[model samples]
Target chain A: MTDMSTRWKRTLCVALTGISIVTVAAASASAGEISVWVWDKAFNGDTMREAGEIYTKAHPETTFNVDDTASQDDIRAKLQTQLLAGSTEGLPDIVLIQDDIAQKYLQSFPGAFEPLSDSIDMSVFAPYKVAAATLDGKSYSVPFDSGVTGLFYRSDYLEEAGFTAADLENITWDRLVEIGQAVKEKTGKQLLDLDMNDTGVIRMMMQSAGEWYFNEDGSLHITDNAALKKALETYAKFYQADLVKPVSGWAEYTGAFTNGEVAVVPVGVWITATIKANADQSGKWAVAPIPRLDMEGSVNASNQGGSSWFLLSSSDNKEEAIDFFKTVWAGDQDFYQDILIKRGAVGSLLSAREGEAYKASDEFFGGAPVWQNFSTWLGQIPSVDYGTFTAEVDAAVAAQLPTIIQGGDIDAALQAINDQAQQQMQ
Target chain B: MNPALLRRGLVYALLSLAAFISVFPFYWMIIGATNASADIIRGKTTPGGALFANAATFFATVDAPRIFMNSAIIAVVGTALTLVVSSLAGYGFEMFRSRIREKLFALLLLLLSIPFAAMMVPLFVMFSQAKLVNTFVAAILPTVASIFIIFYFRQATKAFPSELRDAAKIDGLNEWQIFLYVYMPVMRSTYAAATIIVFMANWNNYLWPLIVLQTADNKTITLILSALTSAYTPDYGMLLFGTVLATLPTLVIFFLLQRRFVEGMLGAVK
Candidate 1:
C-alpha cells in the first residue's frame, strides 16, 4: 500500500513539475524579438525572413521569429479566437492577413491592429492593396504580395490553334470563349480547369469592373449588380461551351495546367511559382492580360488572393517593428527584385515595377518580359472594397454555382444569392 | 457452379472489395511517399524513386525530431492523465453508492452535447489568464478531462466485477488499496482499450493545439502537416512521408494492444 501510494505521489510530483517547467519556458519570449505569423514558408515566410535579416543587420537589436506552422485557416481561427477572447498574449507582433477578409478583422476587433499609415508611406504600395486594410482613413497593413490577375496560357497550344499571343491581348470574356472553342477544336485540350466550389473566376470578373458583393455602404448587393450578373453569365458560358475541365480541389486545378491537360490558367500572380514548378513546362507557358467582362467599366486587369502584413496593437516592440517595416518592406526596392527572382513573389510596391528584375526577360516564357507585362497590368487592376461579409456572400455564391452553370436564370440565381447572403450577414 | 459455392465466391469477392476500400488510402499514402509532388498531382498510383529525396526535404523543412517529441510527450502524458482521472471517476461512480451518482453522470453526459467550438473561446480565456498559453500543459490539460472518455470508462466499469472489490476489502484492503491493487489489475483490458483511444485522440488533436501551441518549435506533427499541405506549392511526397511517420505511433499502439482492446470492448471483466 505504501509502495503504491509513494509511486502515485512521485508521478504526480513529476507531472506537476514538468508542467510548470513547460509553462515557464513557453512564457519567456525575449524582449526585442518581433514574432510574425505567416502561412506559406516558400512565399511569405521566406520573404519576411529576408526582410527581417536585412532589418536585423541594420538595427542589430531587433530579430524576427516567423512562425509558419499553421495554415491560413488555422491562423485565422487562432487570431479570431484570441481576439474574441480579448486575450493578446498568444498573438504575434505581426500577422499576414489576406486582403478580402481584412475588413472582417479590422471591424470586428477594432483597435486590435496597429495602423501603419502614420509611420509607413501607404502611397508607395498599389492603391488597391492599401485600400484593402484601410478603415476610417488609416491603413493598417504593409502590403506584401500582389494577387494581380493574369491569363497564363500554353503558348504552344495557342499557336497550334492558329492563334498568336497578340490574338489573346485585350480580349473580352466572350472573345475568350470563341478562342477557347477554336483551341479545343484544334488542340483537343480544355481551355481551362475550374472548381465550382471556388468563386475565384467569378470574383475576379466582378472585381475587374471595380465591384463586389456589397454596395459602398456595405449592404448586400446581388440582384441588381450588373457586374455580378455578367460575371455569372461568363462563368456559365465556359461550362456551356465545354471549355472547362471540371476539377475539385487545388491539386487537380493546378495539375490540369501543370500537366498540360488545360491550355490556359487565368489566376493571380502568386500562381507563378506553382505553374513554374513543373520545369519541363518552361517556354510553353506565356502570360497575357486577363480577359475583361463585356461591360462599360470593366477592365482587363483584376485582383485575386493577395495578403498584407499588419502590426499588432499589443506588440511590445512597436517602434522596432514599424521601423523594420519602413526600412525593409516599404523602402527596399532591390529586396523586391530578390524575392521575385527567387520565390516568384509579386510585391505590391509600385516602385518595384521599375526594378531591373521586372524588366529582365525570361527564356522560360520564350524570352518575353512576362514580369514586365504583369507589372503593367498590376497598375491597372481595378480596386474593389471587399466588404466584411465577402466570405458569407462567397458561400452564398458558391452554393448557387451548380444551378447557375446548368443554364439557370441569372436573375433568379442572383436573388437566391442575395437572400442567402442577407440572412448570413445578420 | 453450385449455388452455395457461388455465394461463397461472391462473399469472398465482397470481403476483398471491403478490405481494399479500407486499405487503399494507406497504400496510396505509402506509394505517394515514394513519388514526386508532380507525379502525385498527376494521379500516379504506382511507386517511384523519390523516397529519400522526399524524406530529405521533409527533414530539412521541419525539425522532425523535436516535433515528434512534442507529439509523443503530449500524447503519452495526456493518455496517462486521462486514463487515471476518467477511470477513477468511472470506478468511483460504479463502486460507490451515492443518491445523486446517476444524476451527476447524466449531467456529465449532457455536457458532452455542447460542442467544443462553443467552449473554445472561454477555454482560451481561462488558459490565457492562467499564463499557460503556448505551453504543452495547456494543450494537454484541456483534453485530459474529456467527458467522452469518462462516459466510455463508466460504461466499461459496469462490466467490472464488484465481488473482487468486496474480496479485497475483506482481505484488509482499504478503498484506495482495493482500487489500486484489485480494481486496476482486473481492469487492465479496459485501460488498454482506453489507452489506444485516448492516445490516438491526443496524437491527432489539431485545433486546440494549433490555438495553444503558438511557437513553431512547440507545434505537433498534425498541426505541422496541416500547415505543410496549405503551402503555396506543397510537396505532396514529403507530406505523405511525414504523415506515414505520424501514423506509425498510433498504429504500433493499436497493434500492441490489439487483443486486450478487442477483449476490453467485449467486456472488461470478461
Candidate 2:
C-alpha cells in the first residue's frame, strides 16, 4: 500500500508538469498579428475578419487575429480591469465599444485609446457617428454600424386595420397610439412589446428632438426638458390604452415580435438581422421612419443602440492597424455593400449609400428599398453628447418607467429621475 | 386516508416537486438541443429531430477540440495543485505545534471576506509583471491556493487518527513518508471530495480567464459558449448542443467518485 501510494504521487507530479509545459508552449502569439476583441461572432466578428482578409490580400506581411469568444459585458469587464491595473500586456490592439459608453472610457483612461481623426478622414462617415467619439478636437473611433431607428411593422396586420405605408411615415407617437388601437381592434394583435427595464423607446423619443439626459456641459437635464416630458406622457399612453405586451428580457422582447405576437417594433436598424432571421415572414413585414415625439423640434428619425471600433494605444502594429482601417473600413465602398447584403449591417459611411446593394430592393420588406431608407435616416439622426454618466442616468430613468407607465404624474417622475441621477453622477 | 399515511404521501409529493424543480432545466436543455432555434424560442418542450443539424453547426462554428483541451488542462492542473498545497497545509495545521498556528490560520480565513472583485486588478498587475499574461499559467495560478479548500481540508483532518503518526514514527519512517504512505491512503475519501469541488470551480471559472486569456485559440469552452449566446440571433439548438458537450466532463467526474464523495462528505476517517 505504501509503495503504491508513493507511485501514484509520482504519476500526478509528472502529469501536472507535462500539462503545464504543453499549455505554455501553445500560448505564444506570433508577431505581426493585429489582435482584435469583439463580442458577436456573426455580426462584428465576421465583419472584422472579412475586412482583415481584404487588407491582408494587399499587404502580405500583416495578418489579423480577431477573438469573439467573450460577451459584450465580459469584454467590458476585462478591458476595464486591465486598464485599471495599468497593464498593457494582455490588452488587444483594437476593441469594440458602444456609442453611449465611449465617453466613460475616454474620460476615465485618457491617452489609453489612439485618436483616429488625425489619421482617418472624419468627414467620410456620418456626422453623428463621428461626433459620438470626438472629444476636444480628435475622434477616437472608426464608426461601424448605424443604429438609426425604424418602425418595423407587420404589413398584413396594418392592412387588415385599413392602414398603408404612407400612414406610418412622418407620424408622431400619439398618432401611433391611435393607429395601434385601430390595429388591435381589427387584427387582435398588440401594438408593440415593451420591457420596463429598458429605456430604449424613451431615449429614442428624446433623441428625435435632439435632447438627452445631460446638458452640453454634462449636467442632468431630466427635469424642465419638454421633449422628455412629452416622451414620458406618450410612454404612459401606451400602457394606459392597453396597447403593450409586457415583456422582461432580451429573449422575451425579441421573441414577442419575432413570433408575431406583436404588430410593430420601434427599434434600431441592427434588429434587421433578427427580424430577417424569420425568413418565413418575408413580405409580411415593412419598414417606415420611426415616429417622433409630439414636440416642436422632434423629427421622424432617431437612434437607439450602435457601437464603434477603437484602436488601443498599446498596439505594437499601429501602422498596419491604421492602414487596415483606412483601406477596408473607410475606403472600401464595395466592402460595405457586401456586409450590408450578407449580414444586414448598416455601415455609417455616407458614400456607401450610393452602392448598388443600397439601391436594390429587399423582397423581405415588401420590395421597398429598406437599406436606402435606413441610410437616409442614418444621416438625419441628431447627434447627442453621451456623457460619462449616461449609464447612471439610464438606470435612474429605467427605475421610474414602471411608475410612468402606470399613470403616475410625469413631472413628479421627472423630479425623481433628476434627484436619482444627480446623486449618482457625483 | 389515515393521518399517518396522508403525512407520508404529503412528504413524498413535496420531494417529487423539489426533484422536478431541480431536474427540469437539465431536461429542457437536452430537449432544446434537439430542436431548431425558432422552435426553441417558441417554447417547444418536446424533443425534435434537429440534433444532427445543431451538432453540425456547432462543430463548424467552434474549434471544439482545441477549446476543450484548453479547459481540460487548466481544470486538471489547477485541481491537482490546489489539492496538494491545501491538503498539506491542512495536515500541518492539525499535526504540528506552533505558537502562531491558529492565529495564522484565522488570518488566512479572514482574507476570504475580501471579495475577488476587490483583488482582481492587483492580481492582474502581479500576473502581468511576471509576464505570464495570456498563458494558461496565469489562468491557473491565482486559483491554486484557495482558502476555502484549505479550511475544508483542516476540518476533514480533525477526524485523522494520531495513532498512525506515532506508529509510523516508531517504525523509523520520516514525516514525509508518514504523510504519503499512511495519511494519504487513509484520507482518500477526503481527496476525492476535494477533487470534485475544485474541478467544478476551475472548469466554470469565467471572469479571471476572460481578463487574462487574450487570443481566440487560448480561450476555454465556458468563455466560447457565453459569447455564442450573446449573438444578435443566437441559435439556441447549437448553443444547447455545445452546453451538453461542455457539461459532460463534470458529470463524468461526479459519477466516478460518487460513492466516495458521499462518504467523504460525512467524515474522512469513516
Candidate 2 residue lDDT tens string, B88-187: 9988888998999999999999999999989899988766655567888889999999998889889988999888899999999999999999988999
lDDT of 2 by residue, A294-315 (tens): 8798999999889999999988
- Per-prediction count of colliding residue pairs? 0, 0
Q: Once superposed on the true structure, which residue ranges of model 1 sit more than 4 Å away at CA?
A: A1-24, B1-3, B268-270
Worst 10 residues of 1 chain A by lDDT: A20-29
Give per-residue lDDT, candidate 1, residue A379.
88
Query: Which 10 consecutive positions of candidate 2 chain A have the poorest summed lDDT?
Result: A20-29
What candidate 2 gets wrong by more than 4 Å, as runs, is A1-31
Residue B197 accuracy (lDDT) in model 2: 97
Per-residue alpha-carbon lDDT of candidate 1 for residues A2-78, written as tens digits (9 for 90 to 100): 69756765665565665666463663347999999999998899999999999999888899999888899999999
Indicate the residue-level lDDT of A98 in model 1: 98
The candidate that achieves the highest TM-score relative to the unseen native structure: 1
